[model samples]
Target: MIKILKEVFQLYIDRSDFFLEILLQHMAICGIAIVIASIIGILLGIIISEFKKTTSPVLSLVNFIYTIPSIALLGFFIPISGIGDKTAIIALAIYALLPMVRSTYTGIETIDPAVIESAKGMGSTDYQILYKIKLPLATTVILSGLRNMVVMTIALGGIASFIGAGGLGVAIYRGITTNNAALTVAGSLLIAVLALVVDLIIGTIEKFIKRKWKLN
Candidate 1:
């Protein structure tokens, strides 16, 4: 194990450029998917929150998709997407939806009903209430969901290699196939580092949002 570790450390020193490229690809894939999921998830959350009857069904559907294994979810998109970053994005976006939707809904729902009533008394239109009151207050909770989704998407981006999505997963799969434990460990460690960096950045953003909104 020590020998493998030394070899992997050497590999990292030798192939820093290659690993950086893979890391960028991983970030690109996760970034795009999360953006797409955020747009759709936030909309779905707003809709379901407004239309209480739809909440159960919509959440149930998103939860079902979230439960599907990442590989299997990617496979489901293969026929139409034909295996690549696009397919991976689609799968990751689907995987990200549940948390986004749930958080948005819960955040909005948990707000004091009195606040909403006061908004209406002040002649705030529904749209005004949503934008000025509900959404601003719920920002932190929705961001919490986004933070979780971002971390998970980065981890899953590694699996995209199986479908030619080209990320750190490439190294992992290559290591497995060629019996290069060093490569596998290096790839895995890079991924872990990437996830940590992203989470920290998001955590910083969350803190800023809380302070700005005076949620603390």
Candidate 2:
């Protein structure tokens, strides 16, 4: 086991460039997808919040998309987008929309009704109430949703490698196909470490926001 571990470490050191490239590609896919999803999610959340009756149905539809298998979804889009980063981004974006949309909607909706009424009573327009009261109050929840979306995007980006999206997943898939257990272990470890680092950063941000906003 020690010898195998040493070999894996050595392989990582020697192929660090390849690993970095994979990491960059993964980040690109995840970052872009999350950004797009967040915009759409927040907008939909805002719109749905305007109509209390439609919030549940709209969120339910988004949640349903989350249940579809990533691979199957990718396959469904392959013909339209072809196999590459585009399809990967689209799939991950769709998957990410659920948490963000739900969190945003729930966060806004769950705000104190009294507070909203107070804002209105103070001569605040509908736009002012939304921007100043509802959104500010919901900031923590929105951030939490973004955090979840980031984590999910990273995980799914890995699977996107199977379809030629090129990332840590490529390293992993190649390792498996070539029967290089060392490579597979190394690649998987790289992905795990990357995800851990990202989550840690996001967690720190979430904590800061929660405290700053006194959400706790």
- Which candidate ranks first by lDDT, i.e. highest? 1
lDDT of each: 0.92, 0.86
**Candidate 2, residue 7: how far the Cα is off, in Å:** 2.4
TM-score of each: 0.96, 0.94
Alpha-carbon error at 171 in model 2, in Å?
0.4
- Global Cα lDDT for candidate 2: 0.86
State in Å the error of residue 6, model 2: 2.3
Number of backbone clashes in candidate 2: 0
Flag regions of model 1 displaced more than 4 Å.
none
**Best model number under TM-score:** 1
lDDT of 1: 0.92
Error of 1 at 174 (Å): 0.3
